[model samples]
Target: MKRTFHHSLPAFITIIFALCAVILAGNAISLYNNLLSLRNTNSWIEHSWDVKDRLKNVNVLIMDAESSLRGYYLSGNKTYLGPWLTAQKKIEPEFKAMAELLKDNPVQSKNLVELKALFDKKIQLMKEGLAAFNDGGLEQIVMLAKTGEGRSTMDEIRLQVVVMESEENALLAARSGRFYQRYQIAVAVGMAINIMALLVLVLFYQLIARSFFKRLAAEGELKASNEHLEARVLARTEQLSILSRHLINVSEQEKAKLARELHDELGSNLTVLAMDISMVTEKLRPTEPELAERLQRASATIKTTIGLKRRIIENLRPSVLDTMGLAASLMEQASEFEKISSLQVNTDISDEFDKIDPSSAIALFRVAQEALTNIAKYAQATQVWISLRAADQGLRLLIADDGIGITAEALKKSKSHGVIGMRERMLLLGGNLTVTAAANGRGTVIDAYLPFNPAAQADASVAG
Candidate 1:
C-alpha cells in the first residue's frame, strides 16, 4: 500500500501554530511592561534636570551678593553697592523659583523659607549700614559689617542653602541612575523577548517537521509489514503443497514395503515347504530311479525359490543399510548393482564419517540406491563413479555415469519422479540436490549437498 503525507499534516501544523501564537503573546506582554518602566524613568530624569538647573541659578545669585559685600568693605567702594542692589533684585526671583521647584519635598521647602528670611535680614542690615556710611559713620558701619554676629547669621543661612542644594543634587543623581538602569533593563527585556520569540518559532517549525516525518515513517513501516505478510502467506501455501506431495510419497513407500514383505518372506517360506513336500512324495514313489530324478528336480526348484525371495527382501530394504551406516550401505549397493547388471562401478568415500539421525541416513542411502538403479536400467552406461566426502561446510554425495547424456530439452521435458523424490527428501532435511549433464557430454551427474550443522534450521525458522 502506498502512503500519503497529508493524512496527519494538518493537525501537526495547527498545533505548531498554536504554540507559536502563545509564545508571541507572552513576548508582547513582556515588551509592553518594559516600555512602561522606561517611560516612567525618562519622566523622572527630566524633572530632576529642571530642579538641578534652578538650584544652580540660586547659587550664582548668592555668590554675587557675597562678592559685592566683600568689595565694599575692602576698598570702601560705593560702586560695588550698585552691583549688590542689582543682585538683590535678582535674588528674590531665584529664591522663589527654587522654592517652587522644591515644593514637593518638605525638607527642601523648610530650608528655602529659612534662606529667604536670612537674605532679607542681611539686605536690610547692609542697606542700613550703607546709609550710615553716607552720613559719615563709616567706621561704625565697617565695624557692624565685620562683627561675628552678622558673619554667624550669614554662615548659618549659607549652610542651610548648601544642605538643601546638596540634598536636591543627591536626589537628582539617584533618579538619573534609576532612569539609566530602567532604560537598560527595558532594552535587555526587549532583546530577551525577541530572542525567545525566535526560539519559539524555530521550535514550532521543528515540531511540525518532526511530526510529518514520524507519520511518513509509520506509514512506510505499515506498508512493508503488509507486503511481508502477503509474501509469507504465499510461501506457506507452497509449503503446504509440498507437504501434501510428501505425504503421498510416504504412503506409496509404505505400500511398496508391505508388498515386498508379502512376496519375499512369507511366500518364499511357503514355496520351500511345498518343495520339501514334493521331494518327500517323489522319494516315496515305487520306482527308485524315478524318485531320485523327481527329488533332484524338487531340490533345484527350492533353490531358485529361495534366491528369488532374498532378492525381493533386499529390494524392499537393504540389511547392510540398517547395520553399517550410510557410507558402507552405498558401497555395498554399488557392488551388488555392478555384479547383477554387468556395469563398471567406482567409489571414493572419505574415512571421516560421523553419526546422523537414522531417518536422514536412510533417506540419503535410498537416494543413492535409486540413482544407481536408474543409471543401470536406462542409462546403458558402461562406467559409473560414486563419491561421498565430508566437506568443510557439509557432506556431499556425487554420482556420475558415462552414458548417453540427456539434452537440455529432454531434462526440462522429462517428468522423472525419481529425481523429484530425491530433491524433496534433501529439502526436508535442509539440504539441496542438483542434477546436471556431465562436462563434454560424458555422462549424467547427480549431486546432493547436506549441511552438517543443524543450526541452519534456525535460520529457516527465523526467515519464516
Candidate 2:
C-alpha cells in the first residue's frame, strides 16, 4: 500500500534527527580533538622558544667567564676570579637544564651533548690560562694570549653556541608554523560542519513547507468534494420528499373519489334493488308462499352486501374523522380495535385535537389505525394504551401495546410499507413518528409528533 505523509512523516523526522545528532556529535568530538592538538602545538612552540633563550643565556655566561678569566690573568685581581668561579658554578647546571628540556628530541639532545663538550673544553682552556698566569706571572699570560690558541678555542665555542642557537630558532619557527596550520585546519573543519548542518536544516525546512502546502491543498480538494456531495444529496432528498408528498395527496384524493362513487352510485342502486325486492315480496306473499320466502331471503342478502360495502368505504376514508373530530374518532377506533383484537384498550384523548388541521387529523387517524393493525398481527398481548394530547405547540399520539416488541431488523426493513406510509404521512404534515420498545420494557410504543400552527391553517387551505 502507498503511504501518506501522515504515515511516513514520523520516520522521516526521526531519521533526520538521528542524522543531525550523529553529525553534531562527530563535530563535537572533532572540535575537542582539534582543540587538544592546537594546545599541544602551542606548547611545543613555547618550549622551543624557551630552549633558544636558554641557549643564548649559556653563551652569555661563557663570554662573561672568559672576560673574567682574562681580567684575572692580566691584573692578577682575585675579585676578577670571583666572577670566573661564579660563571663556572652556573654554566654546568644551565647546560644540564637545556639538555633536560630537549630530552624528547634525539636530534636536539645530540646537539646539546656536542655543545656541552665544547663548553667543557672552553672552560678547561680558561682554567689553564688562569693557572699559567698564577705560575709564570704576566709574561706567561702574555705569551698564552699571544699564541691565539685560547682565542681559537673560544671562537670554536662561540661558533658551537651559535650553531645550537640557530637550531633552537629553526625548531621554534617549525613549531610555530605547525601550530598555525593546526589552528587553520580546526577553523576550516568547524566552518564546513556548520555550513553542512545549516544546509541540512534549510532542506528540512523546505521539505516541511512543501509537505504542509501539499496537505493543505489536498484538504481543500476534499472539502470541495464533500460540499458537492452534500449538495447533491440534499437536492435528491428534497426531490424525493416532494414526489412522496404528491403521491400521497393523489392516493388520498383517489380513495376519496372511489369511496364517494361507491357510496353514491352503488349505494343508490342497492337501495332501489332493496325497494323492488320488498315490492315483489309483497306481491308474491299474496300469491305464492314459497316465492315470497325466497324473495325475503334475497332481500336479506342484499342488506348484508350493503353493510359490507359501507364498511369498506369507511375503511377507505372514515367520515367520522371530518364530522366528529380527532378525539371522538380516536375513541371510536380504540373501542373498535379492542372489540376486534380482544385486547383491553385504554384511551386518553384531549379535546385540544378538535382544533387540529383536517390534514393532520387524517394522518394521525391513519397512523393509529396502522398501529392497531400491526398490534393485532404481531403483538401477543392483552392490553393497549392510546393517548392523544397537546404538546410542544403541537399534538403527540402514543399507542403502546404490551406484546412482543418489534425488532430493529423488522423496523428497518423496507418491506414494512405500512410503517413507511405512516412515516411519510407524518413527514408530509411536518411531524415525525418513532417506534421503540416501551419505557416499561414490556412491548412497543408508537409515538407520533405532529406540529400544529394556527397560522399555517391558511396555507393548508390554499393548498387544499
Candidate 3:
C-alpha cells in the first residue's frame, strides 16, 4: 500500500496541476478577449469623434467661402477673396478624407455624398455672384442677392452638415457604451480568475490526501482480484492438462488401430499375390524367358510392397517399441533414419529401459522420432548423438545433433507444434522437456525426462 501510494501521489498531483493550468489558461483567454473588445470599442469611439471634427471643419469652410465672397463684393477689396480661395482648396480635401473614413457605414456614406453636393451647389452660387460683380454687372449681383438663392443654398449646406455630424454623434455614443460594457466584462473575469487560483492553492493538499486513500482502496481491490484470478487460472490449467493427456492417449490408440487394420487387410492380399506369382513363374514354358522374367519381377515387386507397408505401419505406432522394447526400437529407428536422411546416429541407450512402463517407453521413442525429424528438416547436421541414462527416480533421454544450432526464439515460439507436443507429453508424465543448442553451439539438442514409479504404475493399472 505504501509503495503504491508513493507511486501514485506524484501522478495525481501532476493531474491536478494540469487541470488547474487548463482552467486558468481558458479563463485567461476569455479575459484577453474582453480587453481586446474594449480596445476596439475605444478606437472606434475616438474615430467617430475625429469624423465629427472633420464634418465641422468642412461646414466652417463652406461658411467661410460665403462670407469671404460677400465681404469682397461689398467692400471692393481683393484680400477678402484670399480666404475664399483658401477655403475652396481645403474643402474638397476634407470631403475626400471624410468619405474614406465613413465608407464602411452605409448611412454615413450616403449623408457625406449628399453633404458634398450641397456644399458644391453653395460654392457655385457664391462664385457666380462674385463673377457678376467683378464683370461690373451690379444689377446681376443685386438681383441674385434679392432672389435669396445663395441664402437658401447656404441654409441647405448647413442642414447637411448637421445631418453628418448627427450620424457621427450617434456612433460615438454607441461605441462609448460598448467600451464600458467590455471594461466591465474584463474586470469580472479578472476577479473570477483570481478567486479560482486562490481556491486551487488552498484545496490542493486536501485533494492529495483524499486521492491517496482512494488509490489505496483501488490497490487493495486489485490485489484480491489478482489472487482470485490466479486460483481460477490454476484450476483451468489442470483441466487443460487432463484434456491434453487424454487427447494424446486417444491419438496413439487411433494410430495403433489403423496400423492393425492395414496389416490385417493389405498384408494378407499382398502375401497371396506374391505366392501366386511364384507359382505362375514355375509353370511357364522353358522357351518363354521374357514371361518368366516378368513373373519374377512381379514377385519381387510384391515382396517390396509388403516391406513398404510394414515400414509405414511401424512409423505410425512402431510395433518394435512394444515388442522388443525402447532400446532395440531406437537402434532400428536410427538405422532406418540413417538410410533416409544420410546422417550418422551414435546411441548410448541403457538396456534397462525395456523394463520400464510401456507408456514411458513409447513417449521416449516419440521424443527421439520428433527430434530426428526436426534435425533432418532444419538441422543441416552430419551426425547425431542419442543418449538415455538413469538419473534419480527418472530416465533422461538426450538427442543432440552437430548441425546449425537451434535459436532461442525458435525454441520459445508458441506455434511450434512438434516442440509443444513433446513438452506437453513430458508434462503429462509429471516431467519436463527442454530444447537447446548443442556443445559449442554447433547444433540443436532435445532433452526429455520422465519420472518413473513402478508401484504407482501397478496401482494405476489395477485401477484401470
Q: For all the candidates, what are their Cα RMSDs to the real structure? A: 57.1, 57.1, 43.6
| Residue 63 local lDDT, model 2 | 87
Steric clashes per prediction: 0, 0, 0
Cα distance off (Å), candidate 1, residue 22: 62
Question: What is the Cα-based TM-score of model 1?
Answer: 0.44
Taking the tens digit of each residue's C-alpha lDDT, what string does model 3 give over 1-464?
Answer: 35533545577678769879977897879878976887887788778888988988987787787788777775477888887998889998998998899989999999888888888888888888888898875557888889988888878877887787787788878877877787777778778777777677666788767878999999999999999999999999999989988898898999999899879977997888889888888888477778989989979988998999999999888988877878999989999999999899899988775767777878888999998999999889999999998887889999999999878887778879899889888989888999987768698889999998687567645754
Q: List candidate 2 stretches off by more than 4 Å.
A: 1-226, 457-464
Summing lDDT over every window of 10 consecutive residues in candidate 2, give the lowest-scoring window: 455-464
Quote the lDDT for 446 in model 2: 92
| Model 2: how far residue 204 lies from native, Å | 25
- The local distance difference test score of model 3 is 0.84
For model 1, the superposed segments whose C-alpha errors exceed 4 Å read: 1-232, 238-260, 263-268, 271-275, 278-282, 285-295, 453-464
Q: Which residue runs does candidate 3 get wrong by more than 4 Å? A: 1-229, 285-292, 456-464
What is each predicted model's overall lDDT from 0 to 1? 0.74, 0.84, 0.84
- The pairs that clash in candidate 1 are none
- Candidate 2 lDDT for residue 110: 88
Q: List the residue pairs that clash in candidate 3.
A: none
